[model samples]
Target: MPYLTTADGAEIFYKDWGTGQPIIFSHGWPLNSDAWDVEMKLAADNGFRAIAHDRRGHGRSTSTYTGNDMDTYAADLAALVDALNLTDIILVGHSTGGGEVVRFAAQHGAGRVVKIATAGAVPPVMVKSDTNPEGTPIEVFDSIRAGVLADRSQFYQDLSAQFFGTNREGSTISQGQRDQFWRQGMQVGLAAAYDCVKAFSETDFTEDLKALDVPIFIAQGADDQIVPIDDAAMKSINLVKNGTLKVYPGAPHGIAGSYQQELDKDLLEFWLS
Candidate 1:
């Protein structure tokens, strides 16, 4: 198993495939790098070096109790990029992974990154504030923490439906899709997973988005229930100096699985462009 050990002693398991321009993938909350398998394969098949790592404390990586915050997450990502000695990278992130991508670029990417793409990502902050009146209420995140503490298994099962929009009308998500989400969520460490709810829900990425100078492709599911398009992708597009927004009319938060082909092609085109 290929792994990169962070400065803080976290072992980040990664998958590196194909050989060409590097495309690094970051996954969402409570899920592992396996979540990006389809997209990674698509990149690899198209003559790109696809790389994805299980974030610290998720999937096969070290599940440390400390350093579950966004800054730490970004630093862990920097460790991976430095360890691989990658340059001119194309970063792709989904959901919380999107937050990680922007944060990493803002703090560490510099000349290393060429382009970025995010799908159904959480960015520019998700929690409501006096200034950001349209954001999701903090109480909603409190409830998520409550659910994680009360019964995480049931919580993940129910969240999976919303994550993939299976609970929505006309959704074509399969039982396997929901099951895989639950399986991935369950694999995460309890402490890390619990701490991450706050990290993904409250961490402000407004400054991070503004710092990006590379071409950014923001893809959103118009009907995304997990991270509403308005609060996330819609707001994110405007913050990036060089950005392109692609809205999928009825897609859900888990667009990578539910709308795989469309996203894969769009990402490939963006990279080639």
Candidate 2:
């Protein structure tokens, strides 16, 4: 139940376990540090310190209505890292958290971070624009906003099916996974969560990806429905000076949960190598 107060006076709830090189986790949109439970345990058991923080508006953090954009999100992450005085960290982000990590690295991570890894992350950009033609259409995100404004609870519940790939043919999501996602979604502040949709979808990470000096590890699912590999991971790999790509065949957007074993193995290998 530890918390860190940001420069903006927002309290961020975080998890810190074990004692070794820190593997800091940033979770996706509308979810909290709880989403990284499996990865945190795995990293800790494997002889590393594991850390995860709820974003400014999600989980146990201060549910403020303002400062829900990428700049604020990245700044909040920077504040957490600074307050902890942690170094030699391996930053790992999933989905929207991926965007947060990259932005943090580009804007603040420099000397503190050793490497970076993202899975099914939203980077380079997720929403289509003049430059990002392959990105998901803006209308898709707009529709999401509409859904959130109309019926957020039902919207979050229904989105979990696709988010976890349960809606796919022959795919089955465990009740536990569904329940966890729903619970996390429901706990998020309505205004902050709604604002985060644009933060994750519209914020471009091209410069962030290009500015990264540390070795980059990109883990993505080939058939990811939420953030397609082609527009995201693929383009991201080419942008980084030192980058490696690993594609999980048929895996979904929630790879950290659905494909935890595979991701943990790969991440451990990268950390050791």
Candidate 3:
């Protein structure tokens, strides 16, 4: 229920729990702080401060139509960290949230942050271009936009099913997980979600990855349909100066949710190392 007012006056909702080393989490597109619930609790229970915030226009945050881009997202995160005067932070991000964390490190993190981690993240670039020919086609993202404009609810439901690999063969997901995904997606603003499709798909994080002087932990889903491994975390890992890359076999975009226990253990190890 806590909120932090951004420089632009947007009310950003955040959850801060426990105390000790701070681990800040940033959720993916159209999702809220709830996306990091499992990770946050795990970290908090282990004597770490876990914090996550709803990006503007998502979840309980103010639903502003403008500033749905990466810059604003990064700035909002930086503002939250500054407001709390948090230090020695371990910043973790998923998908678009990964983009937010890297951008924050490159632009504003500096002395305040200790390390960075991203899973199934969108970085370096997700849309194809001359430089990133392996990226997903712009047409694919266009379809996503059309889907959102058509039926946001159905679109989110379908995505939730695929996001966690529930639609894949030999896969099973709980009703609670499905409901959580749909619930988080439905909480986002329609306009903000629409604009964010472009923001996450097109924004380049090349410089951000290259600028990372601290140790970075990169996790990629080998079967991720949303952001392919080659174009995202894989390439991002190569750019970081002190990066450790891990590829989860058969994992989808929602690795943090689908493989929560493994991810929690890996993160704890990373924090200790």
Candidate 4:
């Protein structure tokens, strides 16, 4: 039970394994660090130090009613990095975790980070606006907020299907996978989960992406249902100074589970490169 207390008094639980160049993992919304077990194991087995934190208000961390926004999320992450005294780090994030990583790199990750990788990540921006016409509409996020308030348990269970693309024809996603997703989502605090919807959807990362000087690897599912590739990774690649884009054909938003092997191969290459 490794925990770090942030400036805002939120306790963040983290997992640290193996010992080499550090690879820190940030998970998506409504899910904990357990979501990164497979990848963390891979990184550890490959002679890298694997680290992942249950974001504040999610999983085993303190579920504070306040500071559920992206800025706080980044600050919590900075606290973890500082506590560990890690350098030359490889930061990997999935979905909302992607947003956290981007913001952290822009704000707190000056000389500490060496490389970054994001899969099924939400970045650049997710919500629609005049400047970003391809983004998802605000109504969609409002519906998500409504769903969270009305019946969150059922909402998470239903969202697991879309997150993994199990609702699609010929999809190979398993029942257990969907069940794990639901389980993870259910562990999130109601307040954090609710506020995070607005955080992930509305926070613009255009400037954050532009601030990165390290090599960035952006992986996206061609058929992501939650965060569309067109609005996220595709556009994110152009914003970073050094960026590589890898799109998984017919992959879903939960590429970490649905397309694990493919993502592992690509990430390994990027990390070693």
The TM-score of candidate 3 is 0.97
Counted clashes in each candidate structure: 0, 0, 0, 0
The lDDT leader among the candidates is: 4
Residue-by-residue lDDT tens digits, candidate 1, 1-273:
999988878899999999999999999998999998888888899999999999888999998899999999999999989998999999999999999999999999999999999998999899999988999999999998888889999999999888888887787888998989999998889889989988998899999999999999999988889998988988999899999999988888886454877888899899889
- TM-score of predicted model 4? 0.98
Error of 3 at 98 (Å): 0.5
| 1-273: candidate 2 lDDT, tens digit per residue | 899988778999999999899999999987899999888898899999999999999999999989999999899888888888989989999999999999999989888888999999999899888888888998998898898789988898898888888887867668788778889988889888889999999999999999999999999988788998899999999999999999988788885454777888998899877
The alpha-carbon deviation from the true structure for residue 122 of candidate 3, after best TM-score superposition, in angstroms, is 0.3
TM-score of model 1 vs. true structure: 0.98
TM-scores, each model vs. reference: 0.98, 0.97, 0.97, 0.98
> How many clashing residue pairs are found in candidate 2?
0
Which residue pairs collide in model 1, if any? Answer: none
Find the 10 residues in a row with the least total lDDT in model 2: 254-263
Q: Comparing candidate 3 with candidate 4, which one achieves the higher lDDT? A: 4
Determine which window of 10 residues in candidate 4 has minimal summed lDDT. Answer: 253-262
Superposition TM-score, candidate 2 onto the true structure: 0.97
Off by over 4 Å in 1: 256-258
Candidate order, TM-score descending: 4, 1, 3, 2
